[model samples]
Structures are given as structure tokens and as C-alpha cells.
Target: MTLLAGTWDGVYRTTGPRFDAAEQVLDCGRVLRVRQFDAFDGVFAATKSGLYHSTDDGDSWTDLDVPREEVYSVVGSPDGDRLYAGTHPAHLYVSESGEEREDDSRSWRELESFQDLPSREEWYTPRHRNEAHVRSLGAHLDVPERVIAGVEVGGVHVSDDRGETWEERKDGVHDDVHHVLVRGPDHYVASCGGGLYRTRDAGESWTRLDDSLDQTYFREAFAHDGVLYAAAARSSPGTWRGERGADAALFESVDDGDSFDVVEYPGHPEEVVLSWTVGDDTIVAGTNDGGVILRDGGEWVEGGRVEAGVAALCAL
Candidate 1:
């Protein structure tokens, strides 16, 4: 088994969710995403410099040659032959499939069509330069041909032809999408800068599902066994940096996101869980204060800690 984690400080790997056992595999810049692929027994980490991949557990890493300096997200095909990287300024790069990547370095090809998605002229970032970013990528495991890209401050884009072409869908969502969960060809839930949006009929339409929460600034969400979990703050990342912290908290929904209620845990009323993943039948989360928490058998407890906010987690 292999588990990889990304944090604002660096990227680390461990036997599982045990942070005490984690070893810093890379001392590079902020790690934003981590992906594990079984086909090559490979682990991939995205950071400020470029994309790095390790085929031999986390003992070694090779930086894939790509022009993008800030890689924010990554996803792999179930077969492990294909890989995709989403980066700053809202760009997507895909690896050439159906070949062994053991000795390949410049294996990624830029998909130029992504920049032509609808309202392409309207996407812009508020805090930085006048450019948006691809913050998250979701691939349909059940349907390998479909993929979704969540653009921060730009909305979500769906590709039925596996990254060759894309259709922009922002009907029930604000332009600022933080993460998108794709359960099927027609089912998806998007947690955005404005609120949470759900779609039962693919990308035809979406409905805001965050009416029960006081804050609309939602970034991440996950669903399992018909139960949906999400977190929210008074605003964006600004809340996590302040002294008081965003009135950040978690919530659960049994009605497929129609409504939600607070999900109690240790120190339930404080702190924000920014990243999540599942490990050995338990729900795992990382907080803004460099904390890792897990819910095993319905009880929540601390797993360990990092020195900065956890950006991503992957278990394989």
C-alpha cells in the first residue's frame, strides 16, 4: 500500500494516513496535489516548480518537463497509461497514452482546445494577474472517456471525448469553482467560491445546494454511501489566515445535497478542513492549522500534523 500527501510546506509520503510515519519525499515548493497510479506503481506530486513522478514508491522522484511553473491539480486514467495535469492560468496538459512512461520525461502534450471553451474571454482571477486557474480535475472512473476540469473563478468544463474537446457548463454555478465531484456521466457536485452546486443530469443544469449553510465560500466536498460531506468558511483563503480564523466548520447531507446539517467532531465548532480522502474504511481530512484528522467507525480523532495547510491527499 502507498499513501501520498501534499501540503503548503512540502509533499510527504507514509505507510498510510499516519502523519507520524510520513517522510518528506520532496523539499520543493508548496505541493498542491498528489496522485497514485497502480499500473506503474507510480506516485505523482504537483508543486510550484513542475510535475514530479516517482515509480519506486516515494524513495525517488523525476521531474517531468513542462512549461507550467504552478501545477495545481492532476488525475490519472484507471489503466494508468494516461495522465493529465492542470496548471496556473487555466491550462491542461495530457500525456500520450498507450505507452510505457518509465523512461519518458517530456511525455505531456498541451491541449489547446481548453483555452477556447465558452466565455473564455470572461475568465479572470481577482487576487493575482488577470488569469484564471485550473484548481481541480475529476475523471469518471466508470466512464473512462469523460473528464471534468474545475476552474477557479472560471467555472467547470466537461469533455466527453477525453480531453480533446470541452463544453463549458456554468448554469447553476458561479464562475469560481474550487472542486467538482463526478460520480457518473450525469451526476456531479461542485463546491465553489460562491456556494455548492449539484447536477443530476450531467451538465445540462445545476442547482445551488448550500441553502442550509451560513457561509457560501465552499472549496471541497466528497460523497460516500449516499452521504455527502462538505465544509465552508465566511470567505475564501483570507479567513484561514486571520487571527480569529474563518467561522469554518463541516456539514453532512443524507438527501443528496438538498440540505445539510453540522457533523460533530472533536473541536467541531472551530477550524477548517480544506482537503479530504478515504483510507482503510475511514474518512480522512487535513485542516488549515497543519492538522490531519480521521473518522473511523463513526468517531473522529487526530491522525497527525504538518507545518502548513494540507493541500491534497491520496491513498492507494
Candidate 2:
């Protein structure tokens, strides 16, 4: 299988079981997300430079011309007719024609309703000069009108009418959300800086799931074949560069979010797993230290390494 790694330097491609031969394909800087949805025909990379689309696997990419250059998150509508992009300044934009339109015809319009959230005034962080970012975006095929957004230092919010209106869902969950993993029409897992949360009623209510673990800061969560996987560091990114490194841990859950068992891997306390994708029969993961590893038959195996820290991954 071919794997794509979105890293701080650029986008890399490798055919693995091993990724020693991974090569840079796109020079876009600081890729935060590399994703492919079943409803969309191409892969998308959200980067500091801009939002890009790759129709020919990871070989080539096209800039989607999002109004803002620092796109942090992207998602497609359930029917693939629309596209949504979230920027570094905590702004939301929607493209009515998606990527199917000609270059000249395609356009993105700002979703001003998102700025009207009740907690908008509190969406700042000292890390980014008191500015926030829309770090994650998600949409479920079962609910086309529903769009969920996770803002870094902001909060988790939902739009039931496809970005036309929004409601705050951050009451029970932490405000520093990093990623929102959509599992069903009304079910989601929010990986936050303070904790990992799950909502069963489309964000109306949430439950913390990381109380049994030592790690409090989470980047992303993945669910496949009834198994849930998550990785987290002891604290935020500022503490990730010390002698002990990230002090990270990887957790596996077979009973949804009820409980978790820490899994041992190569770079235990030094490297944190930042991205995940499924191959033919193995679960592939990318780490902040540029390490690639896979799980086969319940055993973790090393899968070579890339040149730069992998922030996101996609398997095809």
C-alpha cells in the first residue's frame, strides 16, 4: 500500500511495510492534516501555506485557494458537493462547488456565523499571541447537515444547518480541543489538551474517557472494527522537547471508550504518535520523531522512518 505523510517540512510518500524510501512530493510547509474521505474523490492536505487537493494519489497536488493561507483543518460534505476549511485564526470557510468546479469557478465563502458563538470572546491562547485556531473539523455521512468543529483554545461547536448556524457544545468538555473523530451521526471523540471526551448526542453532552490514564493531552483518536486507538503526551507541546521528550503513551480500547490499556512501542517516552491510518491488515502510525510503526496480529512492529516529524498520514 502507498502511504502519505504530512510533516513539518512537506508531504512525503512511501509504499510500506517499511517507509525508509519515503520521498517528499509536495513542498507545502507545516502540514497539519492529510485526509481522504469516501465521499470525496481526492486526498486533502491542510497546511500552513494553504489547503491542497491531490487527485493523483500523492504524486501531484492543486491549491484550493482558500482565502486564508494558514488552513488547519478541512472536511467534505456527506454528498461531496461542498467543502469546508478551518483557518489558523479560528475562522470557517465553505466552498459550495467543492473541488469539482473549474479553477476559475471554484470559490470559498467565509462562514461568519461561526464567529457569533457565545464563547467567542474567550477563544484565545497565549501560545499564538492570544489568537486561536480551528484545529479540527468533522462531518458524518449519516448526518449531512451536521458539521462539528474543534477549536484550539476555543471549544467544540456544531453546525446543524451546514455552516449557516452553530451552537456551543463545550459545556462539559475541555476548551482546548485538538481533534474531533466522528464515529456516527451522533457520536464523536474529541481529543483535547486537557482530556479526551466523547459525546453520544451530537455534542449535546460529553463524558471524559482519560481519567484512568496518566496522559492528559491528546492529539487524535481513531476507531476501526470496534477497536479504538489514541495517543497522548503528559502535557502540551511546550513540554515535549525536554530530556524525557514527549513522555507519551499509546492506548487501545476494545470496549469503545469504557477502558484503555497502554500499549508499548519503540519510542515510548520520547516520541508521540501523531497520526494513524489503516493498511491492508495492519494499523499504521506515524510519530513526532519521524518513526513509522505498524500493528499486526496484535504485535507492534517497526516500519522504518521518514525524514521529518509526521503530523498526519493517509493510506491508499
TM-score of each predicted structure versus truth: 0.92, 0.97
Worst 10 residues of 1 by lDDT: 98-107
lDDT of 2 by residue, 184-281 (tens): 99999999999999999988999999998999999999988899999999998889997877899999999888999999997887899999999786
**What is candidate 1's CA lDDT for residue 304?**
85
Give the Å error, residue 38, model 2: 1.7
Q: Residue 85 error for model 1, in Å?
A: 1.1
lDDT of 1 at 314: 77
- Number of the top-ranking candidate, with lDDT as the measure: 2
On TM-score, the candidate that comes out on top is 2
- Model 2 TM-score (2 dp): 0.97
